[model samples]
Target: MNTKKEKPLHSLFAGATAGAIEAFVTYPTEFVKTRSQFEGKRESPIAIIKDTLKTKGVKGLYSGCTALMAGNSLKAGVRFVSYDHFKGMLADSQGKVSTPRSLLAGLGAGMMEAIFAVTPSETIKTKLIDDAKRPNPQYRGLIHGSVQIVKQEGLKGIYRGLFPVMMRQGANSAVRFTTYVTLKQAIQTRMRTGQNMPTSVTFGIGAVAGLVTVYTTMPLDVIKTRMQSLTARQQYRNSFHCTYRIFTEEGILRFWTGTTPRLVRLMLSGGIVFTVYENIIAVIGARSPDK
Candidate 1:
């Protein structure tokens, strides 16, 4: 009869675990998503997939599943923890929740999440995705790719697109969470007394937020992809050198090449990711045999 227990903690841990598992399960699609965004004149996603399947089969899709799991575990864990902590911080500072405070919650959560988890994850994730469709194709699998990148480029190599990921993902978290909170409150108030916002609305809001973010950050993403994946880790010798070359040579437009696919991926990915995470949290709380 000992029901006085920690349900939110379980939900939090479950959400993190689920998110990490989902990252790996969807690794291939994510790999495709990233590659689809990084293509240029002669590079097409279909061509990349066909070539990859022809050359590698299932391995192509699951290329970065391991790195993805690690990335997502940390990424999701930090996100959930930060959102909770940030919300608490805001509540304490401002005395109560308001629309502006909700938005601030999103902004702070996104910034901190990126600072904590984007670099190493993006480096490994991008490299794995890139190697799958690389012109010369240097890696055999995620393991080999990761090992080679580290050995040749040192520990720094694994964080190639750190800044861009931080920018894009940070903005993404802020926008997505803000949209979610705003929509949730709007829904709550609009309904007469007992009604709550429907799940579909939450998803829609998340999609909108994701769309806004991806479009804004698409250019930076393309550059980051090229810099992280296509470029040699050892060649740049440092992140700054690689970034400088991309900026000076590729021009600005080149930075936005794979924008369309990225938008699509973000919309779908963001909606599902937030929706799933939220639902899973709810389920854990409800099902835990505790008050």
Candidate 2:
């Protein structure tokens, strides 16, 4: 376990930087994934990408990217800072948190981010993406679109799918942090590296954690996306209704509609996020006066 204390501000900065970079680099895959989820029938990532390119050009693949990028940065910053805070409180006298406590901390962090960052941003992103698919797009841009949503629907509009988002995010962080930490510790112990494990190894472990998280939480993700879509109020009454409709109308397989692109993006996201976060933390530590 890493015993060195990390300042919350440092965690925030590193996490935000990591998230922004990851979002920007992996946004095309995310676009494809969301589009696939909206499809009546399952669509391959390649097919979606080709269609998007043909219809909307390369820029089409990046629709709603601004909302997502900003939200991702904020969500990551809050997630890491809150995770560290919770973990610190749960740590033993020796400054180590057990697996269960770490998972709890991650859960707290995920819920915190969901409330403050993820839900609103995700709702906006989903709306923008959905709008862009229309014959006549409604949103002009990020700022304008956001204002329009607020004006038309109020705060509730931008905070659609709060319940599912919270559930998904909480489970997501719990699984991801626990899995990543456990795998990383096991690898480090086997390699006798303590906290000096290679970047490649860290990245590999993080990627595996992402894979685990995706499979476990895919249904929640689909539900969250649907609830946040433009026609959410018209199509579904609540999360439970949305879940039932999807299961009965679409089938259980519908829950995993965008698994391919999500898997790819998250695998890359996990690796990039952890590697960048750790490196930045290391740099910050090295420069600390107390170090």
Candidate 3:
């Protein structure tokens, strides 16, 4: 067996690289998801895509991609780095990572990401995405938008839906890492081989993990997206208020606004990111000092 140990920095790099890749590949779906959340309507994913294309063309599908890519890079990096660090610290007496501990580690990682990376990036990206119809958008770019947010609403505005974001992310990590570990172990056991696990297997497991995360935490995602995507003049004050209004005015079904696009995006992203992450960890471990 390969004896090298994983390093924190490895997780950071792996997560960032994987996140960037996922962002590029699945950004169109993400754009559609954000738009659906903003619309607060029961529109099909195809209808959203057609409308976006008719209105803004191909470029519209990738709007705010720069910020998204950059943000995802940092977001994934911090998440995986923190997760590995915490998981290593919480390893059992036999140096094994139990499923429960893995879940806890994932929660820690997600919360850390929500605080450090997700809030700001999501705020900026959603602002840009929702401003598709405006001729003169208040936020010209990511950096400018960030500055204007602080100038107009202060630091609190930068993190408008922190709680829901945390919830969504927490659920994302808890389910993703735990499921990934379980699936990987299962596959390894089934293979009955001493060689390294295949990249394809890791990717498939990651996709399944992503699907679980989305289904389990979609309500929180809907709430978070609505809270973040509101225009300056919109009425929703906060997460709870937004949820209340959505349920009372729009109906409960509205909360699943972008479920379709979200599922597709998260599935690809989850699989791609985790697969890359695991492979990178292996590489890093092979070269680590402890090895």
Candidate 4:
């Protein structure tokens, strides 16, 4: 096995590359997911997808591919890099706090990732989704929208709702990486009979972990979506203040409004993500003669 320092950056690089490819495949569903989170209505995420498609046709669903490709690649790169770095850091932390230590590592990894990349990408992505569905669309297309955001709002507009974004992404990634690591370790233990634990087990664990992360931190996710969808001026007036106000005023249940659809979405999305990610990694490992 390659030591932390010695291991190729293939996992991180490949993970990001895979994520970008995957993002395009499911970008339409993702647009629906963001809108559902923001609208905070009791409607299902699928309903949101259907409605958008009906109103705007298939063209409407893929409103923000540019934002997604840029943000998601950065997000994926940061996440993979952080997960690897944190994993290395925790390797020396000790036994009693092993899992907890790993969780913390994952948390730190995710937090930094949210700060630098994921949050901003989420903001741009959300705005484009809303913009496409808005009465008077601000952006004609992804590139045009991006350029306008940069021109009118400056780079910050591109990163409108970074706070709750951090919270949502940080929480999501923490659960994902930690769960993946834990499941990998557990499966390794069961590998004694020359029979490995089924890939289903790992994928299932990842899906459950994803659902937990998404639902637990859902309120923040909602806030992030709403904040991002706002215009730059509207966003600047009071994003954090509004987040708190929404929580207090909307009833806590409001935060969980679209949670069921989100759960289903995450399970399917995350399952595909992990399956593709692991297979890619395995292929990379196989080609390495030293392995």
Candidate 5:
């Protein structure tokens, strides 16, 4: 058994590679998810997909993919690197991670990604996604949109929902990593075969963890979406104001908007992400002489 811990730098590279792949593969579902979340409108994922296809062709589904891919690369890299580093720091004398430690590590990782990557990337991506659906679109493409936001609203414009983004990502990732680690550990314990857990098992666990994270953090996500989608000048003020308006105007169920598309994207993407991250780490570890 290889006992050497993964280096944070290696985790960062591996995570960025995995994230870039996940973004492209899952961008369509993500577009649908964001569409439904905009303004708390409840639209069927199927209907959104069909309308997007008819209005903009297949490429429409990838409207904000460039921003998403860019953001996800840094977000996922930061998340994995931070989680690995934190987990190593909190590991027991025997180098085993406890449940509480895993959760804490995930919290730290999520906060880091939220602050550095998710806020800006998501803001830009959401604007692009919404623009594609508008009759009079302001921005032409990723570069154009980013430039417009900066020219009009300055750098702060790109970080519209910093608070809710932090909350959503912090809770979402904490639940995801903790649940994934717990489930994976349970599977290993059940097998007790002294053999490596199959890649399929890893994927399965990740999918389940994704489901858990989505439902648990749906409210925060909805609020984050609403806040981020505000105009460059800042319409909603802050996360609290946005959350209050969402509930008072749209009711409690509004917070669950886009649940379907989000679940679909996360389940598949989460499975792919964890499986790829683990496999890459394993390969790297195997090649190292210390391992």
Candidate 6:
């Protein structure tokens, strides 16, 4: 087993690489998920895809890919670096992290990423998607859209849905990390493989973690998307108000509006991200003189 401590830069690079790969591969699913949430009336994923392709062509399915790709890279970098930093601090003298400590570290990482990377990127992506649906699209591209949003609504516009984003991300990381680590450890112990499990094993574990995260955090995800939307100010006064409106007007099940597409995206995302990140980190460690 490699015992070398992972440098922050390595984690950042590995995470960023993993995130970008995951985002690009699963962007169409993300597009469908967002569109599903955008509508007041529920639409199946099949219907959404057909409509988008019919009206806007194949490129429409990647409407916000650039913003998400960039954001996911930055967000994943920050999240992994922060998680490692916090985990190191909370590790016992033997360098073992308990589940509770792991959860805390994940929470910290999630909150940090939400504020520094997720909120702004997600706001931009959501807004772009919203604008694209308009008959007369207001924003031409990512840079122009970002500029227009800031110009019209100021910094607050770019940071819309900060509260729900933080909540959703925090819970997501806490659950994902803890679950992944626990399952990995259990499988390692059973297999006596130590920390050098096969890539397939890592991917499977990560998929399970993503599955858990999607269900647990779906409601928060919906609220965050809604809050960051173009019509949020007119539709919802705040996070609580948004939740109330979703529940009262749209019904309780509405909170999971995009569950199918989101689930598919995240499952593939988890598998791809963890597999890529772990492999990169391993390669980095092997190249280190100290290893």
Instruction: Write candidate 6's Cα lDDT for 1-291 as tens digits.
Output: 112346889989999999999999999999989988984667899998999899889998989889999999999999999998888888887778889899998999999999999999999999999888888889988999999999999999999999999999999899998998888778766774333578888899999999999999999999999998889999989999999989988899999989999999989998999889988887877342111
Q: lDDT score of model 5?
A: 0.84
Writing each residue's lDDT as its tens digit, candidate 5 over 208-265 gives 9999998999999888877777452355767888888878988998889888888988
RMSD of each: 5.0, 2.2, 2.9, 3.4, 2.5, 2.4
- Runs with alpha carbons beyond 4 Å of true place in candidate 3: 1-5, 39-41, 232-234, 284-291
C-alpha local distance difference test of each model: 0.65, 0.90, 0.80, 0.68, 0.84, 0.89
Clashes of 4: 0
- Name the candidate, 3 or 4, with the larger TM-score value: 3
Q: What local lDDT does model 5 show for residue 63?
A: 93
Q: How far is candidate 6 from the true structure (C-alpha RMSD, Å)?
A: 2.4
Residues 1-291, candidate 4: write the lDDT tens digits: 112432437667666775687677767667766777654355577787788888898878778877787777766767767776766766753432367767777788778778887766776677778777777887787677778878877988877776677677777877776676676666666576445456687568767777777777777767777777755455436667766666677776776766765666676656656666666666777332112
Model 3, span 152-203: residue lDDT tens: 8888887888899898888889898888788877766777455666677767
**Residue 175, candidate 4: C-alpha displacement in angstroms:** 1.9
Clash pairs, candidate 4, are none
* Candidate 5 ranges with C-alpha deviation above 4 Å: 1-4, 230-234, 286-291
- Worst lDDT window (10 residues) for model 3? 282-291
The numbered model that scores best in lDDT is 2
Q: Residue 73: error of model 4 in Å?
A: 2.7
Sort by TM-score, best first: 2, 6, 5, 3, 4, 1
Q: After superposition, how far is residue 46 of candidate 6 from its true place, in Å?
A: 0.7
Candidate 2 C-alpha lDDT tens digits along 210-250: 99999999999999999989888889999999999999999
